[model samples]
Target: MNAIIVTGGDIDISLLENYIAENKEDIIISVDAAITKLEKINLIPHIMVGDFDTLSDDDRLKKYAELDVEIVKHDPVKDFSDSELAVDRAVKVGIKNIAVFGALGKRFDHAFANILILQKYKKLGVDITIYDKYNKIYVKSNHFILERGKLWGKYISFFSLEEKNFMEKLEGVKYPIENRIIDNIATPSLYISNEIKGDKLKATFSGDLLVVESRD
Candidate 1:
């Protein structure tokens, strides 16, 4: 099954609506305060996971309980973040594809940590993509083909997620590169802000790479 984990962060209502419209059959997991956002959209979460720090409304909690939503409450001092727990629940339930929403917000550290959660599930072959108002982020370790008009934004940036050196190549972009070695330990910003130029954008890279497709 596929899943959409909503975290407590800056959420784009339009993006959230689009995701819901597209992934209607997928399971929805609400992480803490994200439930409030879902409530506004008239979306009843399939599973609720968090410490209840942001879910302080007693009536809402009672309503959720009456609706039989699977609630997995955690401690305030737990090691893993609420977002991580939510994604882990999805993975455990045999979800192969996961799309995270409302992950970026005022809390920069939480936002960054939520973005890096992609790496945890990447090794398990779970295709995870984080969708915010201005960006779609995921980790890539092999060949990728991105069509020009289908991209969410005009700019695509690649960064190494490892400490080793590897080769990378980009084609069908404004700034194309041959077989360039990317040394993560030394120079990490070698591949940045490459715009799609033609019909398709092709990328082949060794080692772990984080791809960020962004807009203005």
Candidate 2:
């Protein structure tokens, strides 16, 4: 699958290494301190974008430049955050699917902001995900399937984002909602820790649905 990885410095190197190992052919985009994770793992990224304020090591930055990795330098005084810069870089690269790491869990504000940023990519037809040590968070359009995870430790949760009809159909979960309208800011109290019993768990909603997979 064609994928882009945007790094944000809050990475567990081992976890990042393991996840990207399967998607080796996917483009690697490192942002800010996230570049250091690549340097630590002795891997070169395809694109490194962010303000270099966090990375004080001149030698580390120079090595990637010498290795010919595409670097997009931005001003620290910009309106957008560094992670957004990396996300933009990924879009410019024209990848339809993106998996972002270290974008969550480093800071609460960043994770919340990342959720809001998800809206921008939806219009572009890009499927983006924000993943961390214990969670892989994403959004599903009106219609999608929820099959059992290939790996263990993935518990799913659903939320409605700025829409009234968030959970139109939820099957195989302990609590199932069929054709319901939920508010955008509604608390995701009902959809949590649900397991898929059948071959596929199908959901069709009228508006945006936020899906969170928390691994145990």
Candidate 3:
């Protein structure tokens, strides 16, 4: 089953609410302080995972406890972040597709780490996407097609995560690329701010590609 993870970070509540409404069958997971956000929307997560160090309302947690929400609490001094813990819990439950909310905000480190989690779990055969109001981020290592009308945002960008340069071909976008070498270190902005042209955008790349769909 698909899973939706709510973590402790800035989020667009209305967007999240709409997403949850549309995917009612998907599993919901709350991470620590993120419970407060879900509580505001009158949504109770199926599973809660975190250390609870940042949670402000202990009473709310107790209320979930009364309802028997499966809470997997971790030690405060743990190696993994709360977001990671929540993702791990979803993976343990055999969730192959995961969408993460509240993963981007003021804490750049946490946001970066959460983005890395997409790549980490992708190696384990799980597909994870980090989503916010304006951006959707994920990692892809193969050919993919993004339909125009259903795209997450107006602009799509790609960044190489490989150490060595790799060849890539992109089509059906404003700026199409044909067998171009993408350098991981140099010319990082070579593929930023590309807009899809017709019905769909197709990409075929050699190495790991960090894809970011964004809108201003």
Candidate 4:
């Protein structure tokens, strides 16, 4: 199954929310601040996962539709990022794939951490993608297929998130690399701006590879 996690990041209506508004049925799982974004869209979350610390102490929860909301509260003492927790819950509910929004942040630490969350999904054999106004990031472990219509960030970088870095590859991209190894360090900004000349952008990996399909 697939799910959508709405994180507390940027949700500029003119930029990214339209893409989300159209796909209403995609499970709307809100994490912390994303609850406000859901509120702005006049949509209540199907599920809310986060420590209530970010919210108010008042009974603000009753403002939504009949049942208020399905909230999964966590401890303020835990170290897990809200996004990871939400993704974990989705998996427990039989969701194998997830698309996250409002996760990439305006702050460097938050945005960087959000990108780093890709590692959690990688270990679970799940395909996860994060979207913002400027880019889209995700990963693939086994063989999968993608068509031309999808363009992520201004640049696209694929890396090996494996020990000894034994399984990283890319195809249908501007700079196609052979089966190689990449590290945890930030990748070089070279593989950006790749246009899919036609359909069929494919990649297969032995370990884990993160493909950041970005826009400039």
Candidate 5:
């Protein structure tokens, strides 16, 4: 099944609407404080997972109660972030494809932590896409097919998620390269800002890579 986890972040409402429209079978999971956003949008989450710190008072929890949504409350001292907790719940419920919204925002550390959350999802054999107003981020360890018009953003780039050196191949991009070994010590900015040129683009890499499709 498909699922979506709405976290506490600055998200584009329009993009969120598109995500909801496209994934009709999505199980919505709202993190603390993000419940307000879902309420504003007139959408109730299927499950709510968080410490409820942003709920302000018990009255806020009442709204979720009225909706009969499943609530998984946690302690503020927990190790996993609220977003991670929600993702874990989704996985436990057998969600295969998950789109994460409100993950990119003002807090740089939180945003980066949310990006790293995808690693756990990858290990769990679940596909997750972290989306925002400008970019879509995911970890790719194998070959992937990219279509020019099917991308979320204009510029496609790859970054190393690990320190290991590996060979990579690129095709159908503005700058195509073959069997190039990426050095961990060298400048990785070389793989940045590459544009897709043909109808389809293919990427094959030996090690872990973070793929970001972004706009200007």
Candidate 6:
């Protein structure tokens, strides 16, 4: 089953509500203060994970406790972030497809760390996408196809996550490339702001690709 993790970051309430409504059968997970947001919308999560350092309301926690929500508490001195912990819980439960909301916000470090989680768990066969109001971010290797109207945003960008250069081919896009070498440091803006030309866009690459679908 698909899993959705809500972390303590800036989130668009309307987007969150609509996403949850669309995927009602997916498991819902909350991280720390994110539970407060869910409670505001009258939605209860199946799993709550955090160190409780950012969660100040004892009464609310007790209320959910009474509701039988599975709360996984961690020490304040842990190595990983609450978002990572929530992902771990989902992975441990055999949830392969994870969508993380409230992951991008004021805290740049936390946002970057959350993006790294996509690459880390991707190696273990877990597909994780970080979503915000204006962007959808994920890491992919080999090949991927983006259907024209099914994309999250109008502009699509690609970045190489590896140190070495890799050959990439792009088709069905405004700026098509044929077996072009991509090095993150050398050609940082080579594949940015590409729009789909027709019904779909296809990309095949030899290295890890950080794909960002964004809109203004």
Task: Point to the candidate with the largest TM-score.
Answer: 6
TM for every model, in the order presented, reads 0.94, 0.90, 0.96, 0.82, 0.95, 0.97
Weakest 10 consecutive residues of candidate 6 by summed lDDT: 160-169
Specify the highest-lDDT model's number. Answer: 6
lDDT of 5 by residue, 1-216 (tens): 899889999888888988898887889999988988887778988998999887766777786788798988999899988988998999987888899999989999889998888876787788899998999998877688889999877798887777654646789999897877655558668787889999988988876678899996
Clashing pairs in 1: none
Tens-place lDDT per residue, model 3, 1-216, is 999999988999999999999999999999998988997899999998899998866787788988989878889999999999999988987999999999999999999899888888988999998889999999888789999998888999988777544556788999999878777677878889999998999888786788999999
Sort all candidates by TM-score, best to worst.
6, 3, 5, 1, 2, 4
lDDT of 4 by residue, 30-118 (tens): 88767877777676778888886877644565554346667888887888888789988998887877888887767678777777778
As a TM-score, model 5 comes out at 0.95
Count of clashes, each model: 0, 5, 0, 9, 0, 0
**Which residue pairs in candidate 3 collide?**
none
The global C-alpha lDDT for each of the candidates, from Candidate 1 onward, is 0.86, 0.74, 0.89, 0.70, 0.85, 0.90
Ranking, lDDT, top scorer first: 6, 3, 1, 5, 2, 4
Local accuracy of candidate 1 as per-residue lDDT tens digits, 5-50? 9999889987897889987999999999899889888989999999
Worst 10 residues of 4 by lDDT: 183-192
Clashes of 4: 9
Q: Comparing candidate 3 with candidate 6, which one achieves the higher TM-score?
A: 6
- How much is 62 displaced in model 3, in angstroms? 2.2
